[model samples]
Target chain A: MLKVEVDRTQCQNFGQCVVEAPNVFRLNSRDEMEYTPDVEDAELDNVEAAVDVCPMQAISLALGR
Target chain B: MSPPVVIVGASLGGLRSAEALRRCGYAGPITVFGDEPHAPYNRPPLSKDVLGGEVTHAAVAFPQRAATSDVEWRLGTRIRSADLEQRSIRTTDGEEVRYRALVVATGLRPKRLSPRTATLAGAFALRTLDDAAALRNALHPGVQVVIAGSGFVGCEVAATARQLGCEVTVVGSAELPMLGPLGSALAEDVMRRHVERGVRFRMGTHVAEALGQEAVEGVRLADGSEVACQVLVEAIGSLHNTEWLDGNDVNAAQGLRTDSAMRVLRADGSSWRDVFAVGDVARFPNAIYGDEPASIEHWNIPTETAKRASRILALQLAEDPRLDAAIAERFAPVPSFWSDQYDMSLLAYGLPALADRVELLAGKAGGDCVYGYFVGDRMVGVCGIGMRSEVLKHRDEVSRYGHVPIGEPAR
Candidate 1:
């Protein structure tokens, strides 16, 4: 599993991450950004992609604890 | 030891290129040259947040990756020129570096008018962190500010300056700001928003001369009008930084002309497989837009082009059988750009400027709305304010629109 972190203050809820990693990140009813804390190892590419697409540069991923 | 793949321009594109090369199983050495002393940092906020608050390089710099930890970063080293035939570049500090392959990602420098017309002290152009920091210091409450070119950066800075309590005025040669890209309908809404926030617009005219002795006191417009302001910002446009490739025989005058594979071309239209360009400096054809090659300066282009370039270039370097197949893959990157002016966040996909016709798809003209940009009957792009989901949905549709594929798909 991989750990995902998003700086809420920096994130503008662009939802670009939602488009790239649909299985991990999402937008709530209010349109604010939300994401899974842990993702499968197979999702590393998708997760990295989500990190890249974030206009705020607020997303990061690391190995799960 | 084999020469490293040297990537010029140590910004997002250079960093992404290095990472993509490693991902493609290229075990060779990599070197990235950047003129800035600081490492790669996101530049979007330079026109927004950094102008409102503190300016720190560490706050915005890209996180260090273990994969590229070994990659040599020649920061603070400016390349004077490149010798394409010799496969080497010389730095301004009298250092020569050779590379087996080169990635041109030098990007651009903001085109300035005050340098010749007015003093540099109170003039600004926001492209780097330093520019933002300097501009931030000058943006005091109730200070008169004049911005040239009411484009993306100009309108953005106008918004930021207003937030800082600066009396802001944007000089534009169009009836509305962002009229070229957003079109008149959406652009009028944007201008209205700016006007509501106390930002003034001087439309259908541009700054002819910035007048001052010690610093910019005001500007004389080409229409024989004058606006007095203490601070002047020229966000007119950007000039290509392709001068370093001067004697290279490549058609870099417009931009570093490249094929769909990112291979740079000679003036005679022959491509140099070893030299590639990504980001704002590269001009490549988007079949979705037509066969006419253009340099799309959208923020997403650097990442997309670098990844594609590195993927194919890695295969070629490794002599992998997959090289030809990789080159044959269809690369139709949907250009995306966004602007955060106050509470109104404008997001778009595809090239809106390429459209001859625009139709309102959703919402009110004065409020949150989505616009479909069309070239004749075919939809070419989409732009919206506050309708993120609706706007994003059109990305695929526009990307698939008129995709005259130059090569066979990998599948």
Candidate 2:
């Protein structure tokens, strides 16, 4: 399992993350950010791509204990 | 035998291109040349954390995200001349290298101030890690700093200087800072934020001259007014680093002109099949901008263009038939850029240069808000401060209907 965290204060919501990992992160009707805190190990690469494309350097990922 | 793939300018674009080649299963010899001795690093923080003494050059160096450990790197070397006819480049160290495919990512250099002002001891320009490190050390509490130009670099430096407890004043030739790309509404918001933080602005005036003979004592404005300062930082503009390609048919005056697929265009309006250009140095036509040849300085353009160039280069080298259709596709990516100043972060999507009108879609104009920039009826660009989610929603809309009609209700 993996845990993901996003610093809301630092995030500008450019949606580059959404384009990379749509299953993990998304935008709601009001265009606000929504994401899953935990994900399967198979989704690691997708989540990592999201973390890399973040413009504000807000996303972080770590393996769960 | 096909020659090795050669990449010039080992910055973000060059580094990414190397990685993309490997990802496409290109196991051939790959060589990267960079004039800078250091590895590719994130430049956005040079004006932010680097100037504020929050981080060192090593801290900002780009992480090894791609599989480029095998790529041969020639650091601290410059290509003096290039022979497009022979498909070879001469280096400063009296070495010539041949290439089957060439990728030019030379990027840009900061436009220098006047000869008089540029030669001043205390005056500086921020473009590389060394520049940021020196400026950070020079800036201290109570030091007076005057910045010329109100672009992203200039505004960001002012914010960092202010955070360092320095007396900062910014001079710009426009009525409002960044009024051209950000529009007047959002530009006003940015100006208000700076004023509230005690940073002074000298709008609609240029820096006529740099004061003092030995060092920069102050700067003289076009209005015959002088602002006393100990240091002067010039952030006027940047020119493409295309001097080495002088004898070539490239549009060196503007930038290296390229076709839609990022192929270099010769003087006769034809593109070189084996040569490609990326990053700030590539002036290529974009479908989103109505096929106009535009060079984007944003951080995202380099990454996107590099990916496209690598796929094309790999296909040619490997003679892969599986991805032949992919090569015919045009190079189009949703251009985006961000600027951090004080506590406010401004994020924009699409090319705002084509917009003729700017409208406040959400929030107050002078406050944290979102503004939609339109070219007549179509929305060409969107930018907002502290309105991250609101601006992200319009990303697809801006790409699909570049001329999306803005309703009167939003206005």
* Among all candidates shown, the one with the greatest DockQ: 1
True C-alpha contacts between chains kept, each model in order: 0.29, 0.43
Best-matching candidate per TM-score = 1
- Stretches of candidate 2 above 4 Å error? A1-14, A27-52, A57-65, B322-324, B401-411
Candidate 1 C-alpha lDDT tens digits along B120-211: 67888889988888889999999999999999999999999999999999999988999988988989999999999999999999999888
lDDT tens digits by residue: candidate 1, A2-44: 9999988898777889878999988787767788988899999
Candidate by candidate, in order, the iRMS in Å equals: 1.4, 2.6
Consecutive 10-residue window with the lowest summed lDDT within model 1 chain B: B402-411
lDDT of 2 by residue, B178-258 (tens): 877787777888898899999999999989889898999999999999999998999999888898888987676577888
lDDT of 1: 0.87
Report lDDT (Cα) of residue B403, candidate 2.
26
